[model samples]
Target: MAFGTVARASKRFQAFDLLATLVVVIRHDGTIVFANSALEDALGTSRRTLEGAALGNFFVDAGTLRTAIDGARTNDFATLRYEAQLRRGTQEPLPVQVTLAQTDRKAELLLEMSPQEQQVRQDREVRLLDQAQANKELIRNLAHEIKNPLGGIRGAAQLLQMEIESRDLIEYTQVIIHEADRLQSLVDRLLAPHRRPHVVGDVNIHEVCERVRSVLLAEFPHDLEVERDFDPSIPEFRGDREQLIQATLNIAHNAAQALAERRAAGDARITFRTRIARQVILNKQWWRLALELHVIDNGPGVPDSIKDRIFYPLVSGREGGTGLGLTLAQTFVQQHHGVIECDSVPGRTDFTILIPLP
Candidate 1:
């Protein structure tokens, strides 16, 4: 693994291979001493070819990288950072954020390149996490406030009905009591996730999917079709089995409802897919391996108007819908340090759930 005058310490650089970012160690003359696995994959080239090549040549504008390398050689600054277009074999040049710094070994410089899109995705995930935390606080406070008055309203209605001598008047009191009871139920559901402790245990994702599938089939036996595309290689991880089942069932049920027209046409289809993702980032943390479970449906997709707001509590596209299904699903998945994303168009809607795996 030796290149130029750099030391043969390939074993020392093995840690970089685990990183999602591309890293390369170069000599003072700008010849690559070592290239990480990430870099090799990004360039669509092997490490053997990358190790001896000039790192600058891989960039769209080599001059920018050359200047940055020269600056690193001198005591110009502790580190240098900039945006650059990286060239790959035949693919379009990729936009990346580049960072250059000197290593302990004076003769070698460490350079890191991360795709700009990846950075944006990480930022989005962080924002989603922050937003979820805020939502939890808001729901807890709001539910408690609603719960106190709700009990009083229902109790008062019950007492009023007992005192009412006129049958018509008693009927009105009954309506009040019934409506209050409904509101109470809604409040309880709003507070349900917070009330229950997250029970963790070994969870086989396939089992979760199968449970949801059987339930869905039983409910829509005549029309809806539930399919499975599971990866046998995915191993079981520690999580709440009940929570996962409920989360998956919520998404699948929503899809089934959305497929109302397709069901009548006898072509409603919902797919449960599972796969393993490697070197993935979720909730601002990196996982060497992650589980990607997708719930895809062939139906009239989520309405474009409310697509973005679908995950928000009490937001629903369907009429008379409580809209808590997707919200609870998102909350349950987040409890496992995962996230759910929805991609919808007119014909296809995909809900992907990603969770870090051991």
Candidate 2:
């Protein structure tokens, strides 16, 4: 009977080893006692190497680990959230999240990591929120200030054209009228998305990519190339179709413009790649499946000065740029519960959009 009981207990222990999340058990004196299989898999290390080593040894900073251990001793479980560099042997340090907990017989630590892509998504969301709010306010004020005077300017130009006897003077009046009409059109474009009704439906991300691809190819027939790498297994998501198209088009347009200079030089390429990232956390919410779409280009990257504030309303690196392209892109994506981010370096630039799966 005792032998059977021991076997059952051992089986349960093995089950825990198999199913447990990444965790490491350590003695009260800070010696590693045991590490679950998940931890081993995550860190690429074995229990033999981890045992008897202080938990702090794995952390880039010794003081942070010590403080967490001290807090755990008093509170039974303590979480310390600071940036740490994780290393195993000669490999480069990896950024990780370290949480320490204390039990009656042993202490345990849990390490989690923030992927580079997800981190960028988060930063982009924050910027988008700020930019959208600012742009909303700006548009409201600008429209009120400009709309009333625009009609008068157009009427005055028409009146001046009728009275002017000289052909050159009439031509100048026509130019004024033309400029006023153009400004009105520009204002309408800026306000059109905001005023239109949102048409929500089930959207296949691949379809959006394909539409953007066709448009981009038609626009830059000889000067550029647009590539696609999609995962067909992903399901359709809930969003506004026209809004998504515009948002995607804005980003793709910027990529095309960036590559224009390179296109003239005979070295230009743009790629659209899509995949599903599992167990992703966005805006402090964990998602089971998030669609990741990457728009990459081979061109001069974003300038360093405006990199951080590229999503801010009216911020642009180009001289004639209105700087509303990315701001509008972010607003539309966020409206559909998505995020857009950019990372750029010399000769390579990547813009990533992540939206939750239905």
Candidate 3:
């Protein structure tokens, strides 16, 4: 009867192993006695290999593993935060956060990760929030100071044109009216995205990207190329459709402009890639899943002097640029509780957007 009871207990342990998130039971001597399915999947190793292996063998850094193990031994339950680089057969090292805990009978450690690919996502969100507030103030002041006077100037030019009888004089007045109208349109474009209503619903990210791509192709036609690499498995997320379209379009337009400048030099390219990342921490809160979209370009890259302030209102890199495109893009993405970040070097520039999924 005792042997039968032991056999039943072992079967129950095996059942629990298959269902848990991650469970690794280690002996007091620091050898792995049992590992669960989750643990095996995370480490990309089989149970047989892990059964007798030392717990520290999996950690990227020996010192961190020793410190965590020592802490767990002294305290009944202990947790240590450290990054472990996991080596899977031929794949690159995967960074993960290892949390070790101990009880009187067994010690268990939880391994999770915030992949480097998703780094700076939360920081981008905070920066976007700040940018949006700054833009609101900027638009209000600019509209009053600049946009209001634009109408008067255009009207004055019309009145002047009527009084001046000479053909040359009238032509000069016409130029003034045309220039004023151009500035008015620029300001309108800057404000249009902001005036859009907040329509919240399920948003298909690919649809947004496709819309941006079609618009960009129409605008640039022969000179530029826009490519897309999307993951159909990504589910619908919550956001405003028009706002996301404008936000993505702004970045793509900037890329097209940058590539145009490099067209005379060599072949230019812009790629839009999307994937899904898990276990991300955005705005100091953990998210189980987040959409990762990257707008990459091969151009001269953003000037270092203006790189840091590119998101600031009225900051522009191109001639005649209002510098509001990126500012508005940042604003709209932040409204969706997402982030947009840029990394530029000589030959490569990437604008990454991270939006949380429902």
Pull out the clashing pairs in model 1.
Answer: none
Task: Rank candidates, TM-score, best first.
Answer: 1, 2, 3
lDDT string for model 3 (98-180, tens) is: 55666445454443344444445445656656667887888866866888889999999999998989999999999999999
* TM-score of model 1 (CA atoms): 0.93
TM-score, one value per model: 0.93, 0.77, 0.70
How many residue pairs collide in each prediction?
0, 0, 0
**For residues 88-130, could you state the per-residue lDDT of candidate 1 as single tens digits?**
8789999999999999998889999889989988887787788
Which candidate number would show the highest lDDT if scored against the true structure?
A: 1
TM-score of 2: 0.77
Alpha carbon lDDT at 147, candidate 2: 80
List candidate 1 stretches off by more than 4 Å: 1-7
lDDT of 2 by residue, 154-200 (tens): 99999988887999999899898999998897687677767888889
Which 10 consecutive positions of candidate 3 have the poorest summed lDDT? 109-118
The lDDT per prediction is 0.90, 0.74, 0.75
C-alpha RMSD in Å of predicted model 3 compared with the true structure: 5.7
lDDT of 3 at 149: 88
Q: Residue 20 of model 3: what lDDT?
A: 25
